[model samples]
Target: MNDSSSGRTRDPSPAAEDPDLVRARAGDDAAFGRLVAPLRRELHVHCYRMLGSVHDADDALQEALLRAWRGVGRHTGRGSLRSWLYAIATRTCLDAATTRRRRALPVDLGPASDRVPPDGVARTEVAWLGPYPDIAITTGPLGPHARYEQREAVELAFVAALQHLPGNQRAALLLFDVLGYSVAEIAAMMDTSTTSVNSALARARRMVAERVPPATQQQTLREIGDDRLRRLVTAFAAAFERRDVDALVALLAEDVTWSMPPLAQWYAGLDAVADFATEVPLGSCPSWRSLPTSANGQPAVAFYLGEDRTGTHHGWSVTVLTLRGDRVAGITSFVGEDHFVRFALPVSVGGETAVGRCS
Candidate 1:
């Protein structure tokens, strides 16, 4: 079997020779841990893409792993253990999705606001899309025939588009197009027929094609190259620190968009985005500082806001930048202190000591 985690083939007779699988089958919990430790990160990424929220993915992956442990005795060893686990995980995510509403971005709910509302409130009741820390994603595609690189699969646009799909369609698309599974394999994993899987895939393709951009951020970054991309994000962070709205606006594309999830308002076009940048982040906010970070495989920054008396900067948001050619085309600032924890960022930045960049 191929170890998708390492991109290498495993010993063909591992089901018979591997002691971890043998012990796991005999109900040794430690043995089961050893057997699954290698696949955890990638599986979590899969869950995140399927569910659209890291918290939901954490719950679903835990539930699926428990299910796998409980049912390990049923494994026939006819297929790779990776495939079996994925089948269980996908089913678990589907069940969870059925009971909950699909995650969404503010733009998905309505038309973009031309001007900021006087009292724009965070919609706590809505299950908004959450950002994924790039630390969780590995660099390459999971399989030989996979269409999207692993990073591209978890890109914000792709994951957001997945939320627009039905559970079955989403599963079929991810398993087939992203993970490089065969139609027959997906059908069996999904407990459906090849005809059904094909139908789901076709519908999913059309919907995602309509929503996702023509260029993935991974492709754009590669075109920009590392040196230039580094300089770009550095300049972005500096602009916020200096509170220079003109410097920030110079980094955006003409069709740029700025949206903060949980907040019901989003601004589109260069004019509106610049206005929001001027009014909210630059003009109204107290003190601003930022550290470069990556999210959903895109260049991002961890913004901090300092209160008047505290003299300390608190974590504000993880703003992921979507680039078009040389300029930012989209800015999705996921505002919340909880997000800082997920990215292993400090909740507070003290005076004079500079924060380091997160890769």
Candidate 2:
């Protein structure tokens, strides 16, 4: 293996990840960029899973790339490029986690509110989990040893569970089980003994198993079938457009929960959710346009609202729906127009009906 800092060429074999390794090692910025392009999205998502914030993932990934670029010459390619990048990313997140509080949801704070909190959510007191753009999360087996499916790993339930573990345990668990790195490889990544890595993995698995539900959203969606799923999301969107409370309630579970982030106020049970709908959102007399989409590996819809249906309905929020059986079990509405950028969703819905995956 060659160590660039030593001004040596000990890399006798072609263990390099790319054929252009020579150029990348010689400080050709474009070559390095080209070399890492294919892995960027996956790497970013990996950071998001570690830190639980889209914004923090952006910063961590940027820093990791900078570090990786300067040190690329030392990557003698003894292992896969993917694992190397992941090692850098995971360490970067571990560093960030020490400074910031573990990301959280309103449920983690207290019992559900019977009514929307009047004082409003204080952002400083809460570190809400930001939604990840679906574009960055791909579906398929990440590697032979991976346990969770790509989408299943990103679900809100799974990400929330990861937050409870210590930073090292979190990194060890994600690297070994979710990303498919072996115990020996994870030991190297975390700079710990293989026995220590196994210990962390065992503790992490126990905690995550206790918190995560028996059934994942991906499995639920699979059983629903694509056509039925589309029709269901489309119908929910239509009901919102019409503000038909009865139709909306019909799709909800009797114990449905509705939460709006940045507000810290969540409603539980059918009656409470229906009351909030009648008194707040639906009662506001705003016309809505919803485009169905997917988030956190579950069904979602993006809303745009306006005084009338003529020009454009400005971006409102993205609602992710959780299901139990065939009914919506919970609704998490991440409010604010700021969420549009990640989805490549327009700030406003114009002439045509709002378009996306139809969830």
Candidate 3:
């Protein structure tokens, strides 16, 4: 088989090697690479959601790929190749999760004073989940698979909230809920009983509900195209950069929610969100810059600000904006420098002051 885009012939056909499927079954690395390479990006996204951290997902993906390559020869071809890879990837995530506690954002913790304490409280260790590369999620021609249809599950809030569950529970939930795996299949992959799988899934659901707010079940936001989201985000950037709280308020939904993670307190409603921005230190900062990015399949901004006499660009936060209709419904500000590189975001905005008005 060969990938036409890359122009690389990977592995010869099993039938070509052996009509009985004996030779190709006897350890062909080329065949194994061919089988898994096409699915790497999706598998990485899966691992990211399961682990709730991009760094962890990357590690788990590498491990899963290695395991799949080594074990591909043992395949009897009774199951779909995608399903088998998922089994391996899920197991790898479970193992990793078992070794580490679930990560939380600072917003998950209660808010402290905006002023830096002299003692300097250590930042919360909540698993600061990173955004997946847009190319990974949007790339390639998608088939009619259920996995392709459930792209929203990969969003930042969804993935970050997932970290609250225990590893096994996370695995069970994703397998059953997102991947639509059968109970018996999940049990086999988990090496546990069906009852246990059910229990894990239940716990996972409760945890997800508690951490990630219930999104509107209506399909209004799901159909939002990239262009529309970009326009809304640009408007937001322009309003904030120009210190036009009125315009900002106009763009927000009546019940918009504004949260800065690692700090659990959130402001709700357009009035409250507007007040928080205009009254808070974030609003008072003299110069602000925002670059467009996507997290969890939603529009986001990587924020930066001018600092002191040094002209250095101080890292501020990532705002993951959730849209409802043409308005902003939620804003999650993930603060700090550690998350920037992981998201593959630039340190500073290139030019212009406003959102759509970028030069």
Which candidate comes out best when scored by TM-score? Answer: 1
Q: Which residues of candidate 1, in runs, are more than 4 Å off?
A: 1-13, 139-141, 308-310, 351-359
lDDT of each: 0.86, 0.80, 0.67
lDDT of 3 at 137: 72
Weakest ten-residue segment in model 2 by summed lDDT:
1-10
Winner of 2 and 3 under TM-score: 2
Off by over 4 Å in 3: 1-30, 111-124, 138-148, 206-218, 222-228, 261-272, 279-283, 307-316, 336-345, 351-359
Clashes of each: 0, 0, 15
The candidates, ranked best first by lDDT, are 1, 2, 3
Candidate 3 versus the native: TM-score? 0.75
TM-score of 1: 0.93
lDDT per residue as tens, model 2, 121-217: 4466788887887877864224445677778889988998999999999998888677677788889988999999999999998999998888888
> Which scores greater on lDDT, model 1 or model 3?
1
TM-score of each: 0.93, 0.90, 0.75
Identify the leading candidate in terms of lDDT.
Answer: 1
Per-residue lDDT tens digits for candidate 1, residues 1-359, read 11234452232324654778888889999998998788788789889999999999999999999999999878767788888888999999999999988899999899999787766788999999999999878642354445676788889999999999999999998887778778888889999999999999999989999998888898899899999999999989988888899999999999899999889899999899888878877877767778899999999999988753246788889999999988999999998889999999988786643333221
